[model samples]
Target chain A: MTSATKTLELLSFFSEQHPEIGLSQFCKLTSRDKATTYRHLQSLEIVGFIEKNPLTKKYRMGPAVLPLAQIRERTVPRKSAAKASVEQLADATGETAHVSVLSGTTLYSLVAVESPKHSTRAIVDLKTLPLHATASGICTLAYGPDILTQTAKQNLERFTAKTQTTEQGLDAAIQRVKETGFSHSKGSIEEDIYGLSAPLFDQSGTIAGAVSVASVATRFNADAERTIKHQLILASRQISHNWGGSIPNPIEACWSKTLAET
Target chain B: MTSATKTLELLSFFSEQHPEIGLSQFCKLTSRDKATTYRHLQSLEIVGFIEKNPLTKKYRMGPAVLPLAQIRERTVPRKSAAKASVEQLADATGETAHVSVLSGTTLYSLVAVESPKHSTRAIVDLKTLPLHATASGICTLAYGPDILTQTAKQNLERFTAKTQTTEQGLDAAIQRVKETGFSHSKGSIEEDIYGLSAPLFDQSGTIAGAVSVASVATRFNADAERTIKHQLILASRQISHNWGGSIPNPIEACWSKTLAET
Candidate 1:
């Protein structure tokens, strides 16, 4: 990797749980020499990508991300457009609802909302959903560009026993998503979590992302699944319209047929 | 500059007006060689900092910023904590209200809210507020670290005739802010915008940011300025408490004395 990429990669190590990282901690996280990691941190710090806490002397995300995010939202606006729909989906389904956007071949989680009704619920925590192992990923592969299928097939890392690890397994999953206009994953990324997602579209009239509902597997009965699927379809439609697109006629027809059968 | 800083600098060129740029456009914008710019763009694209529009082939800020913004909000939470207070300030002052955070020697605009009451209200558009020409920047220099004063002195670019372009002028302005626990700038950054700001604090018991009201100069009478100052003090206290800080005893005493005189 280029030094630039390595510097950018260090930013990915930060999250809600681990917001601050010291120089030595960065050394351990990236498995790079201390000098190299410190240099990378310095580069990021100079550009305002990261800042050191005055007390702890640990690095956390800096203010520069805010303007970039503002520009991104003003340009694309997918996250803000999907927010209300995802929140409504979570409220309606009493589960966790999230939206993921497709950039290149990767599925990046845009936003997630967990319902307050349940004590135990699924949390959508992954920054990038693995294409072969998550419902949103499978939905994207089924509906997005053909290049994504090749990308997914190349990195079919097995996460759980239910994760699709082979080309054939992933193809079957994609086919199911294509046929039903929805994707389902049972214990794919984690045990006792069930994910249901429907494809969202943008102004290009092509798949742009997915709106999903994740529920506790133990409570995911047929009625719950039916409710979640219905909510997912509503969320996808609303989000697509907000993004200046609509569910394609074929996907709408598929969803209608699948809902009737369910 | 290192290759990494050069690569990250490309992101700054993107704004609300120029959201997307082609490789040629980037080269022109940065005044760098086309090949070097292309390599920098490639490194950025690899890490999802920028993505090409499928049709336009121009690059814009990508999904990676959303996650980093999320982490920053989760860690520092200054924006969310200050949002309500700024909104209230705008409502009370009938002007544009904004919050700016101090990162190193720079004052970064965290969030801004415009009151719909006026059709020709001031708009806080810039990402970084200049220390010599902005109320927030002057407030930070008056109350934040001494390093900021030196930094502001080094680069006092004049934005308007009223801008403080000399060390003595800036020092005089900062002295007034330090005395009153408030900062005021009249047509400093822009021709007809009047800015009033009060300092905000974080848990570190130091000035973290400032909350300000930007008013159209024509409508900024004595009554309006007094109302804005009163509202700013309220906002500063509320936001400081939300950020796990309080107005220091001396600043509180200064505000009380200043308001009593007003």
Candidate 2:
């Protein structure tokens, strides 16, 4: 890997749970020499990508990311457009709803909203969803660019007993998603989470993302699944339209046939 | 500069007006050699910081920034905490209200809300506020760390006739802000916009940002100034408290005395 990529990789270590990282922690996280990691941290600090906390002397994300994100939002505008639909989907299903955008072989969780109706609800916290283990990821593999399947084949980290760990198993899941016009996963990533997702499109007339509903496994019944699927379709259509794309005719036909049968 | 900083600097070229930049365009923008620029662009693209548009082949920001910004928001919690207070400030004052955070000598505009009450509202569009020319910058100079004043003196870019271009002129403005516990700028950045700002604080027991109101120059009368100042104080206090900081006793005293006299 290039030095620049190595430097950039350090930023990915931060998350909501571990927002701050010290020099020693960075050495342990990257497993690189302490001096090299420190130099990378200094370079990042110089550009305002990271800042040292005054009290702890640990590094946290700086303000520079905000403007870059703002530029990305203005350029793509997927998150803003998908927000209302996702919120409505969450409210209608009483489940956690999220949108995942496909960018350069990565399925990124663009935004997630949780319903207040349930005392305990599923939360989509992963920054990047694994293709073989997520409903959104499986939906993308079924509908998005074909290369994602190859990418998924390379790294099928097993998260739970139900997570597909082999190419054959993953293909089975993808085939099911293609047949149903919706992606469904039960206890895939988490033991008690049931996920349902529908593909979203953008102005490029390609699969741009997926809008999904994640529910507690105990609450997943036929009626709830039906409602969630209906709401997911509504959300996908709304988000796709907002993103300046329409549902492809084949997907629309599949949804019609599947819903008719159900 | 290191290759990493150069690679990151390329991201700053993107803005609302110029969201995409081709390789040659980037070379022109940065005044760098084609090979170096292309290498930097490649590094950025590899990490998904920038992605080439499929049809145009021009580079725009990618999805990686969204997750980084999410981490920053979760870590600092500044934008969400200050958003409501800024909205209330705009509503009460009938002007454009914004919050700018100080980071490494740069005052980054965090968020801005424009009141629909005015047809000709001052729009806070710049990602970074010029230290010598904006109300937020001056407030930071007066009440923030001492190093900011030196940074302001180094780059006194004159935006309009009223902008402080000289060290003496900037010191005079800083003096007034220190006395009144508010910063004011008349036609400094734009021809007919008046700005008033008060400092905000974070949990570190130091000035973290500024909450400012930008109003139409013609409508900025004594009553409007008084009202804006009062609302700005309220906003600053609320935002500071939400950020886990409070107004310093001296600044609070200054505001109370200034308002009582007025």
Candidate 3:
């Protein structure tokens, strides 16, 4: 990799998971010559991104870079929108509801709330996902903007028994998402897991991201598909509207599907 | 001041009150030439400390800077020792309890907790104050490493009506802090507010910081001053012990003062 990319990679070493590292360890981790790592560290230090412990000589992220995390406290983008709509989705279906948005190639949880009666829960980490398998990712791929075409071309790792691996099958699924204005996958990402997702469009007319209510597939069987599909579309429309998203004639789009909700 | 000091002075332009600044306006605010200001911005940006909006060109702090705030979130430096004691301080006083540690000439907040009672709310902001009048600053001034002698010799901004301008008077106050192991002030640095503070040493026997409880003097008068002082010193000692700081019998030092326990 280029020196610039290596420098960026060194910066990534200071993640929330591992906020501090030492000089020798960082050099070993990056597989850099000690001198190269030292140079990058010096450059980073001069600019105030990373700091060394004056007493210990170990490095942690510096005080100069703290404003970013504090602002996330003020603005969790689309989180409020997702919470409002996901509740409605759960009320309609009696299943867990959550909102996950694409971050880099993976998905991140904005926020999540469960149905009042559900006994089991979907476990997840925010902003960590394999792109090809998740319902929210599939929705974005199918009806997502031009970006979906590129993601599908990358390695589609099969994570579970029902993961869609073939490029043609994934394309067909995307086609289905376009037709239905929502996406569904059962046991595709996790065993026995079912998810229904719909895109939340922004004012710029791009599919900003998606909202999904997930549960075990047994709770949402073949007989419940139409009802669940209708709820997903309605909830997505509500969220898009609240976020100042311009979804022109959203109800009319739902009418194009076999749903009577429109 | 040198260019580096001027660059440090640029921080005065940003505060809890006004976090965002336009580049053009920042040039005017800093009184630095456009090229010089641009250079500062470039250095700041390179460190991932700040980011400018591509469209608006307005600069707010960047996301990569959050770990600095995280360090302060531990609330108490030595959690097992300090956390419970500090909470007791807040409960006893019905005011905000704060601990600020020296970061060069400036003080940085390590922990802050609001009072439990809604009526006696706290007005604590993590803004730095000069080491001249504020009780915590005075406590640190009184008991800090010999650096206080060096700092006071150089930069002592006369901040308030209660601010001590003369070196001799300030030295007496510092001598009082070292002797008494606590500091008290009434409407000195800020109007209508009174504060009690005591210094805390770390396990290594270095001046770690000062813990303070502040309240409106109207509720806590000269009669209540004895009680506030009592609580502050006790809490500070307890927290210091928690920090593994064997500060030569701090609790005994509190007993000698007229500050009575309830």
Candidate 4:
């Protein structure tokens, strides 16, 4: 095979199973001679697709990769889950359901659906939902700054009557999520829309994301809170188990403020 | 920055908005000299990240890139779109939801969710599903032999009462997907579960992947026929639109296949 093909194959070698690899192992995987592998590795390193550990000499994907992957994955788009649980949630509550991620402060939409009878064929545009307003954002805020940092870069935008643009306001919002194990957002992004979000953790003890049940406010009132909360928690656990995401500790996003200065 | 870095910066220039660029214009995008840009382009071209059209002399991402992006964007280990989607779909349906890619006559799962109510999550272990048994795999069968030839490499395996093992059955299955906009398999991949799936197309008019919702016999009965058919059409359309895919004319996939094979 050509050196170019070997270099390209090098990236594929680093996957969720093995995000980092030693030079010798990489050479073995790619079936390239050591010298040839090292030479191309240098080319890849210079190009910012990879970085080498000074200590172990292992290589992992670099920062440059994240932006490209993020944008492409988002624009490229698409969803499903621990299905039985979601079905139960729908059967129990009869509301639209969703799970989402935070990308640069926008609620990067992941997946969602509504009951066919009540389903209005919703269009949850996989665009950014501002952090100050959605249940999904509160979960990210409760975990840490990675979500907020992305949001801050976009400069918080207020879209409706319930919008909160200040840092302090966002902090207060996440605190509520930490205390309740779920967050409730009322029409912050869209008028008359109310959503309850809970954290979905990864195997690594991180908040992988948040799952929320959305309903028009008239239907999600206080009388329905207990049932809704129960379903949301159950759905979150099912998805976390499906994902093998661990429940990470609550975050102190004040660090996010510090990072923002950087 | 180095010449290699500059070359990469040029790539950032290509987005969903702009996918190809000319020589002098490419140099302008990178702010490098004509000669220097030519040399850097040659280095990148030699490595197969980008290609220069011998006719137009313009550059676009090369063949080596497509699969890397596919594996990274689809099969890579990171938390991705399918993960988020399955989680939401599970909560919405109380059934299992999943996403998979065609892999050697089987569908390799990138994501899946378990149902909350089902005492048994028939799909705890996620991996390749037989081509004839799975909703995702049958949907994938809609594509031409170029892709099916790759899938047929698996030789297929029979799982339950309805799994297709022979090449003729598999070919007929592909023909079924072509005749119908959707495909269904009963008690195939797993016993007592009914499966339904639809083709997911990419912007360039290729089958990118498939999404599916599955259920036990009781849950996926006649009432399901209407609900699932409606949601499947909607869900597939949402994802295909995200990939910039339009409703494909069967003949177009045929033309693309002929050109690609030649």
CAPRI verdict (incorrect, acceptable, medium, high) for model 4: incorrect
Please state every model's RMSD to the true fold in angstroms.
Answer: 20.6, 20.4, 20.3, 25.9
C-alpha positional error of residue A184 in candidate 4 after TM-score superposition, expressed in Å: 66
Clashing pairs in 1: none
Q: Return the TM-score for each candidate structure.
A: 0.41, 0.41, 0.36, 0.35
Q: How do the candidates rank by lDDT, highest first?
A: 2, 1, 3, 4
Candidate 3 clash pair list: A65-B65, A66-B65, A66-B66, A68-B62, A68-B63, A108-A127, A142-A174
Give the per-residue lDDT digits (tens) of candidate 3, residues B1-262: 3343344345445543466678788889877788877767665555444556554677655433443444322322354336666778888877888877776677766677778774755576757756777788888876666777668657666656776777887888777776666777667666777878888765445676788988876787765666667787678776665553545555355447544432
DockQ of each: 0.22, 0.21, 0.05, 0.04
| C-alpha lDDT of residue A56 in model 3 | 64
Candidate 4 residue spans exceeding 4 A from truth: A1-262, B1-79, B103-106, B117-121, B144-156, B202-205, B237-262
> Which residue pairs show backbone clashes in model 2?
none
Give the 10-residue window scoring lowest on summed lDDT in candidate 3 chain A. Answer: A64-73
TM-score of the A-chain for all models: 0.71, 0.71, 0.64, 0.59
Q: Residue A172 of candidate 3: its Cα lDDT?
A: 80
